[model samples]
Target: MTEAAGKSYDGLPGAFRFAFSRSNSWLFKLYVAVALVLAGLVTIIFVFALIVLIADTVDASDGSISLLRSFFVLVGLLVVLPILAPVLFVARRHRREIGDDTGYDRRLASTGFLFIFAVYLGLVVSTPPEQQTSVDGALGPVLEVLYGLPSIVGLVPPVVAVLVIYGTHRLSR
Candidate 1:
């Protein structure tokens, strides 16, 4: 039988793994399942709030799609993934330790920061025409630095999560 049928998230702390534990108690498992669904609902609500916040903060002059506005919204949306990544990564790693290889962890590790970099790189290519022409001046450098700062900052959390997860995994081994 599979581990989930009888095993639990052995290496994880009780607090960390409570929702993910594969305990034998049917009621506990059902409660966890319901909690997960509720968590998903909360995340959906968060995304909607983020969308509204971004839309309000970014001024799209004449109701046209400004590259700067798009950048803000995309970065906001991108943040949602990393927010949940570490918890999910830890749970999966602990589950694997207990002999439950669901095959999702491999995909998660392989993708890593590729998605974040890809989207950020795409945004980098969309430099506002006004900014492009000022490339030779002093303000140009400052503007470019300011423009790229958000994407650079956005990369930190996911990269840190990956490093922390790898470090912990290595130590566990």
Candidate 2:
């Protein structure tokens, strides 16, 4: 039998060739690589924040605030994990779809990944804790719960979620 040839889209139209070529365009690869790296970094940061929050709880001056802060940190991780895990899957699979002739939702998924990350960034670390509710250096009753990262990280998920929903819908259609 004749040797099986590699994918040959030499005669295909330019756009089709680009889409189904046996490799990713530099743009797609770079986008995915950057996004994945960011996600990993963010995950590590979240874990570290979690550990700090937990360790701080043992001898916290005010147990309520410590407990609340710890609770929010844990909640934030739960939210982040779902979004981050899917990104890793889509990014790896996009290699074939962009390079070796495959079909899948790449742009939409990548956008979702970045969107969630940006949101988490805002929610978890939106403001400096020292400045959140420290007016004239007189701590307020709301000081503890008010300065947490989760409250701010909360902003990212909804926007990312909306984008993801739209992207998925477009992909489906």
RMSD of each: 12.2, 11.0
Q: How far is candidate 1 from the true structure (C-alpha RMSD, Å)?
A: 12.2
Instruction: Indicate the residue-level lDDT of 152 in model 2.
Output: 49
Residue pairs in clash, model 1: none
Worst 10 residues of 1 by lDDT: 102-111
Off by over 4 Å in 1: 1-19, 22-70, 94-162, 170-173
Model 2, position 29, has a per-residue lDDT of 45
What is the overall TM-score of model 1 with all chains considered together?
Answer: 0.32
Every model's TM-score: 0.32, 0.45
Q: What lDDT tens digits, residue by residue, belong to model 1 across residues 1-83?
A: 45663364444244236434533334434434443454466457767866786677566455454564566556555544443
Per-residue C-alpha lDDT of model 2 across residues 1-173, encoded as one tens digit per residue: 11222232233232223333333444434444454566567678878887777787767678697678767777666555545443333333333343332233345445555665556455544566555645444554344444554664556655667557456635643
Error of 2 at 38 (Å): 1.6
Best by TM-score: 2
Q: Evaluated with lDDT, which candidate comes out highest?
A: 2
Candidate 2, superposed: residue stretches over 4 Å from native = 1-25, 60-70, 82-105, 113-170
